[model samples]
Target: MDDTEILSSSEQKMEDASTESPADAIAVTHSSDDSGDSDSDSEDEAESNHQIETLESELSANPYNYDAYVQYIKLLRKTANLEKLRQARKAMSAIFPLSPSLWLEWAKDEASLASSDNVPEIVKLYERGLSDYQVCSLVYWKQLLE
Candidate 1:
C-alpha cells in the first residue's frame, strides 16, 4: 500500500480499537497538567479581598462608630483575613468589650471543629481571643476532650 493509505488504515484501526469514531476523536484532559490553565477564580478572590479592605478602611475612619466596627468584623471573618479580624477585635473592643454571648458563640465555634486535622486558622482565632480579649472562653475545655 502507498504510505498515505497505510497511515490512514492504521488510524482507522486505532479508532476502531479505541471504540472512538474518527469524527469523535478528541483530546483528553488531565487536571494536574498546567496546559490550558485558567486563573479566573484567583482573580475573583483577589478582587473580593480588595473590596473588603477598602470597606474596612472606610469603616475604620470613625472610631466611635460601633456599627462600622461590626461591619469590619463580619467582612474580615468572611474573607478569612486574620490580621483584620485581630485588628477589628481590637478596634471594636477599644471602648466596648465583646459581650459574653458573642464570646461564647465564637469560642463554641472554635470548640466544635475536628481536632486531628491541622487547622491553623481556627487555632489562631482561639489564641487571638484568649490573649488579646482577656475574655474567658471554652477553647481550653474543648481541647481537653482530645
Candidate 2:
C-alpha cells in the first residue's frame, strides 16, 4: 500500500477503536451515576475557578490579550456568572470598540436579560456597534432593524 493509504487505514482503525457503542457508553454512565458522588461536581467547579484565576492573571499581565478575554468571558458565561460576565464584557468592549462580533455578542446578551431597564442600554450598545460597523456591512443594519 502507498504511504497515504496506509496512514488513512490506520487512522480509520484508531477512530473505530476510540468510538464506544451506545449501550456500552450508557452502561458506564449509569454506573457512574449510581455512585452518587458529588466530589466530581465540586472538582469541576474548583477546576473552573482555577482556570478563571489563571485567565485573570494572564489578562492582568497583558491587558491586550483579546484571546484571554474571550476565554474568560466564555468561562463566566458557562458558569452563569452574570456579574463577572458583565465586567469582562465591559472591559473588552472598552478595549475593542471596533470589534463588531464583541458588540453583537454583548448586545445579544443584554437582550437576553429582557429587562425593561436594559432597553436603553441595549439601544446604546447597538448604536455604538453601528457607529463602528454600520457602513462596513449591511448585516449590522439588518440586526439594528430587527
Candidate 3:
C-alpha cells in the first residue's frame, strides 16, 4: 500500500480503538451520580485519558510519530493540562524543529499565558519558530505579528 493508504488505515484503527468501551480500555471511576449526563461525561473523560495514554505509548516507541504527538497535544489542551501541554510542545519542537504548525501552536499557547516577565520567553519561542520556518509560509509571519 502507498503512504496515504497506510495513514488512512492507521487512522481508522485509531478511531475504532477510541470508540471502544471505556471499561475495557481505561478504568475511570465516576461519582455516585447515576445520571446519564454524568455517566456520559465520565466515559468521555476516560476515553480522552485512554487516547492520551495510547498516544504517549506510541511516542515512546517512536518519537517521530507526529500524528500521535499532535493528538496528544490536542487532548492535553482540551483537558486544560497546561503544564503537560507546554512540555509536549517543547518536546515536539525539539524533535520537529521545522514544523511550523507545532511552533505556531506552541507560541500561541505561550502568548496566551504571557506576562511582563515572560514576554521575553514568548518572543524567544517565536524567534526560534521563525528561524526554522521562515520561508515555509506567511502564516508564521502573521502569527509573529499578532
Poorest stretch of ten by lDDT in candidate 3 = 23-32
TM-score of 1: 0.42
Clashing pairs in 2: none
The ten-residue window of minimal lDDT in model 2 covers 17-26
Tell me the TM-score of each prediction against the true structure: 0.42, 0.66, 0.67
- Residue ranges of candidate 3 with Cα displaced over 4 Å: 1-36, 136-138
RMSD of 2: 10.5
- Candidate of highest TM-score: 3
* Tens digit per residue, CA lDDT, model 1, 26-48: 12112213332236435645776
Report the number of clashing residue pairs per model.
0, 0, 0
Output the TM-score of candidate 2.
Answer: 0.66
lDDT score, candidate 3, position 49: 84
